[model samples]
Target: MAIKTKNISPDGKRQMTMQQFTAWLGRFDADKDGKISRQELADAVRGAGGRFAWWKCRQGLRSADSDGSGYIDANEIGNLVEFAQKHLGVKIVGF
Candidate 1:
C-alpha cells in the first residue's frame, strides 16, 4: 500500500516541522481530547505504514507517558516525536 502521510516529503528525506507533525498526529486523535491514547498512537503508526505498530506503540507510550497517565498529553507529545521519527521514519524537524 502507498505510504499514508501528510507531512513526509515525496522523497522522504526532508524534515517535518513540529506544527506539521502535530497536525498529522492530530488526525488520529479520535476522541478529540487533544491528547493521544495508546490505541490512537498505534493507529497513527499503522496508518503511516509502519511495521510492528503495537510493539512501537508500547515502547513509545512507555517513554512518552511521563506522568504514567496512560495518555500522551501536550507535554508528552514531544517525547513521542522522537519515537515517531526513529521507528516510523516521520523525520520531525526537532524534538
Candidate 2:
C-alpha cells in the first residue's frame, strides 16, 4: 500500500520544515523519553492522515536509528527527516 501523509503541499509533496519536525517530535515524545517509539510513530503517521504499517514503520526507524536504539532520537531526527524526504518525497522546507 502507498504511504499516506498530511501536512503536504499542494504540489503533491510532504513538507516539513526543521522547526515543524522538532515541534512535532516534542509533542509525541511523551513520558519525557528522548526517543520516539514505533507506536508513537504509528500514531503520528495516522494523525498525519497516513496509513500505519508495522513493517514499514520499522523500516523507517531502522533507517534513521543510527545508534541501533530502535528509537529515533534528536540526534537521528535529521536522518529521519532525510529518509522521509528522500524515499517518501517529503520536502524539508526552509532547508
| lDDT for 59 (candidate 1) | 96
Residue range 1-95, candidate 1, lDDT tens digits: 22344554665743677877778788889999999998998998898788888999999999899999999988888888778778877676655
Clashing pairs for model 2 are none
Which parts of model 1 are misplaced by more than 4 Å?
1-14
What are the per-residue Cα lDDT tens digits for candidate 2 across 8-90?
A: 68878867778776676567666668788887766555555554446556777888889987888888888787656644556
Alpha-carbon error at 94 in model 1, in Å? 4.8
Local distance difference test, per candidate? 0.80, 0.70
lDDT of 1: 0.80
